[model samples]
Target: MGRAPQKVRNRDTNPCIDEGDASLKCLDEHNYDKSCCSAHFQRYKNCRKYWHSVMLQRRGDGVRPDMPTAAERQELLDAIGGKPY
Candidate 1:
């Protein structure tokens, strides 16, 4: 018998992610002046970090909860056959 599909947040449309994207867009519109949009930049960083944690947790592998660094993110992207953005 076929099992029903489980529901999960759609990454592209998640509200938290959308907010992060909006914050990024604003920052870009302002010429990427971090001093001018530090709060928005911080929010985007936090949102992306949380999403990364959630994804690692869902992998069912023993992933640590330590704060991820840029190198770690690059490593993960490489392991997953993706290019670092």
Candidate 2:
């Protein structure tokens, strides 16, 4: 058997991982039918959008690492005064 969707690791260290995992799970459950997972797709897209904006803002501020690592993300969340997701 293949690995469970929840067990899929985020080696990329990008943001919105939970949304990505949910989309994967939806696709798995629906036999890879994209139409059946539209909501999950939309959510993942929105998450990418939100994080991209944050990345751009940080870049403008001259912060290194346009995309934050996992540990940096928690500091970012604290700095931003709450979690976006």
Candidate 3:
């Protein structure tokens, strides 16, 4: 039997793609040296942490779709007027 096709996700569906990509790009530019990509990695980590908190808050408040849709995420960010982290 053939394996099932893998589903691809992008920044829209996965909010942290840009931060993740920046970290990866840093790694590539630095020839896979971890030290040079520390800031990128930290940024990615912060992004994930911020989103996770939002998800948890939504879940606690009994919001539908615990992970907000892209538009909803954007609205929340706009309302806050800055980065969650």
Candidate 4:
């Protein structure tokens, strides 16, 4: 009988993004160094732009442009049968 084939271990292997060295020939063709091109390094610039938009919206204070006036506040209070303190 032929000997059984050895089982290969997959747990220790790193994915294409985490390898940190360009083992694939195609990345070398594009002059991209895996050590520098990992997604962790490239993600910050995209995230920063999104965060900047969120911060700008927060800085606008929660008031809408067509907000109500003091009369509206009194009407609301009267409807509830009480005035705001």
Error of 4 at 3 (Å): 73
Where does candidate 4 clash, by residue pair? none
lDDT (CA) per prediction: 0.59, 0.81, 0.83, 0.42
Segments in model 4 whose C-alpha atoms lie over 4 Å from true places: 1-35, 62-85
TM for every model, in the order presented, reads: 0.42, 0.68, 0.82, 0.27
Model 1 TM-score is 0.42
Off by over 4 Å in 3: 1-8
60, model 4: CA deviation in Å? 1.6
Question: Pairs clashing in candidate 3?
Answer: none
Highest TM-score model number: 3
TM-score of decoy 3: 0.82
Pairing residues by index, what is the TM-score of model 4? Answer: 0.27
For model 2 the local lDDT of residue 77 reads 77
Rank all candidate structures by their TM-score, best first, as comma-separated numbers. Answer: 3, 2, 1, 4
Alpha-carbon RMSD to native, per candidate? 11.6, 7.2, 3.0, 23.2
The number of clashing residue pairs in model 3 is: 0
Residue 38 in model 1: lDDT: 74
